[model samples]
Target: MTKKIENHPIEDVFGDEICEGDTYFVFGNETVLQSNLKQYLIEKQQVQCYEAI
Candidate 1:
């Protein structure tokens, strides 16, 4: 099975409930990193991290 990030902005999913100081978790395999939105959230926003199992 393939897991991917939604091709939309985080606000689309979380609505206005999410804020800069709040932390949220997105679950997916390493492939999720391939997504531009996900990559930007991790790299540019510095809100996500990767862990190898």
Candidate 2:
């Protein structure tokens, strides 16, 4: 609720818009992470990803 919005202008804002990044993460090592988990199990779903925290 933005703390009831009293004097809520530039209070060290970190949520009102300052996002300049996208996210994607798949690691490698053990033979390329087992070949990308066998290409994500030959087809997988469920993706809505974001991370800057």
Which RMSD values do the candidates have, in order? 11.8, 17.0
Query: Where does candidate 2 clash, by residue pair?
Result: none
The candidate that achieves the highest lDDT relative to the unseen native structure = 1
Minimum summed lDDT over a 10-residue window in model 1 is located at 27-36
19 Cα displacement, candidate 1 (Å): 29
Clashing pairs in 1: none
Candidate 1 residue lDDT tens string, 1-53: 44333442344232334333343444452112232456557665689677899
TM-scores, all candidates, are: 0.26, 0.17
Q: Model 2 segments beyond 4 Å from truth?
A: 1-20, 29-53
Error of 2 at 23 (Å): 0.8
Per-residue lDDT of 9 in model 1? 30
Clashes in each model (backbone N, CA, C under 3 Å)? Answer: 0, 0
